[model samples]
Target: MSSISAHGLGGADDLPISGSLAIVGGTAALAISFVVLLLAWRQPRFGRAGHELAVPPPIARVLDGSWFRAGLRVMGIAFLAFMLWPALLGRNDLANPLLGVTYAWLWVGLVPLSLLFGPALRAMSPVRTLAELLDKGTGRSGGEGVVPYPAALGYWPAAIGLLTFVWLELISPSSTDVGVVRLWFAFYLAAMLLGWAVFGTTWIGRADPFEVYSTLVGRLSLWSRSASGRLVLVSPLRNLSRLRPEPGLVAVVAVLLGSTAYDSWSSSATWIRYVQSNEVDVTRLGTALMVVIILVVGTTFAVASMTTAVDTRRSARKELPRRLAHSLVPIIVGYMIAHYLTFLVEYGQQTLIQMSDPVGSGANLFGTADMEVNYWLSQNPTVLASIKVLAIVVGHVLGVMAAHDRAISLLPRRHHVVGQLALLAAMVGYTFMGLYLLFGS
Candidate 1:
């Protein structure tokens, strides 16, 4: 088996780390949180004061033009075509591009693309494109269907969908099978279309797992649609702050982090030995473990947010988790980058090469069949390890800033510093846990 086949869903193998560096990393993360609390902006700055950088008039016009949007829809159709081609007739092994397309390309490829381009996958989602076409064909306005969406549902559906996808990837024994993945996509398509039919485009955004995932990461992108619906560049933090606080916001964030941590943990030899020693069904055990991790992590953050003093009504206090949830987005993105950077670089290339000969007929359609994937990052374990640690630390710093800014905006003046302590501690613990996953995975 190839290194990627083992580490594709898992993380990089055997990263070297110094004990001193790990300690320094943990210390720096906590110290920076305190420093930000003590000396950062007292007034709520990020609340409504995001700076927007202007694009040239022509560029803006071109970006917002119909041609660009149609092109994106075309891209969505093209991906669907790729899926149908191999999904129906391609070989069953890793040699077929279907497996790589699902795992390496789409699963891991979403991170950087969302970060740089802001929900490109969502925009180019084939299911979404088809839904829009259906809506237009039916002559609906504002993409609303016969029935309105249930406001109470919010992102809860998307949260569940995300968990389901992660469960299949991390827990299902047959996850690597091309046919299994194809069946998964088939179900995904049917579900997306059904939801889209019931609630329209709004439903797709709120209920589709990949759409929510991409849009969440897209919050970190430099480009975004402003209030007036024109695409413009803004500070990543400001973009992050603009996230719509909805039901299951914490649940979504928790699943992202917990499943990722579980992915790392599930790959360890220790976990293998534990499973081997037990007579419990692996699927049931793994499923239960993943759910427990998500609940524990999400509940921990929620409780930490409530630890601070609040003079507000109990209703407002109950909303604290949602208010503080945006603070964790950067940390999730950073950790995702930390965990998948090298894996994506290596296997992502391999996926591209496989794409050239998707059906195993030895066709060089994309002219990349002979390309060799570079392993320079793997060769220098120290550099890769350092990058992973630094990514976590930087994410920690940004998360602290977000939490601080959010506290000042919502918490009473007297509860400011003390209220943040619990959140700060949570950030510290989360960072340390992520570091341990890196060093030990």
Candidate 2:
């Protein structure tokens, strides 16, 4: 069987270090906790039940109507169109400008949205929605509830996706790979839909990793103070606003930011050739990167949970373990910053290409033909690529801090919004810069 078929989901051959790190960190924490429990066994304490994790709230009453649902349907069709675009018109005459917009919307745009909204994509998630439709058509409910709410799916799928994402970064990290990547995504979408066909969203939610993280974070956050200043931990940390960041976090974030700085200065031609060559199996590299990312992020979740647990026990007037469990959030956060920063760097160039020659792109049903505004803005002295690096750091801070209970409320809006706007603004600026380089009067 081919590598893709064998792996099913890419990144099956993940590096052992990731798992080792998780196990080692978890085991160490467990051991330390065990020792502490033994030491404090005789202390008189109130019996508090072991806390259960909290999941993201269900989609509250939508202020809008089926419009949101319709949009999801449109996205599904658009994704299908993008997958078939290259086949319809051979690569030579392909309308890149149009394709660029579609790619941007699906990736850059959707990423921040997903991160900020706690699996917001799941609501109108093209993949899930498509899966639901297919399940209905096939007369299969997949065994249970609708769309397996995030709580049901747990965190495995996301861990898989994160791992896959890292693998892609190391391997075919090119805009051209969009066609293949989109196709891969569609396949996963099909699988998810099939999952619904077999089990439904309710079941999937129980399996979603993000939901699991959310549950864990929310429950532990109960020690987190509420907006009213009382010990209400059900919600997020309201005061957890993004700060200037600690030095260690800054260093890690710098590495991530610096990755983009280097990429922006490199020729995309060089990077593309490296990936397509014999040295790298486009599939293998993709898988490896994905696993690497998941490990890093998963480790972060582990550390954060430990931190919350420590804080929670202390708040409850219990003798808590003093060990610094998995104090690796800085490293993990730094890597996440690097992963995302690299994407933005490459996107800067793609946006530029579209802005320089919109009409040379030909006509498309999507109206992405003349989206040169971004490229035009990129040329302005004020709209520096450096700003994008800064945004990465800011976004990381937002993502991490918002995970806390008392701090989450202060932000009000989801942190992902900040990242999304930063990316969009950067794209606009870069596109405009490219336009000037190509056709400045």
For 1-441, candidate 2 gives per-residue lDDT tens digits of 011101111110122233234323333443344334334433312112222233223432231247765786678667556545543443422244334443344433443443344334445545555556666776765645444444323344644543343234333545345455556556655655556654576534433323322322222222333334333223222212212122122222222322222222222334447766758665555445434433443343333333333124544212111111112222223223323333333453454444344444444445443443333322332333233323433333333333322222212333423322322232233222222211121
| C-alpha TM-score for every candidate | 0.94, 0.46
Cα deviation of 169 in candidate 2 (Å)? 4.9
Least accurate stretch of 10 residues (summed lDDT) in model 2?
1-10
lDDT of 1 by residue, 1-441 (tens): 234444532333434546456746665766676676667577887778437877678998987788998899898898779767777888887777777677667777888889889988876888888988887898987888668988888899889889888888888888778788888888888888888888888888888888888888888889877777777898888888888889888999999989988877777677889989989799998999889988988988998887764755787777888888988888888788777777778877888888888888999999999999888887777677777777888887888888888888877777787888888888888887787776654
TM-score of candidate 1 relative to the true fold? 0.94
Candidate 2, position 59, lDDT = 31
Prediction RMSDs, each to the true structure: 2.2, 15.5
Task: Write down the lDDT of every candidate, Cα atoms only.
Answer: 0.80, 0.35
Off by over 4 Å in 1: 1-5, 8-17, 277-280
What is the total number of backbone clashes in candidate 2? Answer: 67
What's the true lDDT of residue 378 in model 1? 77
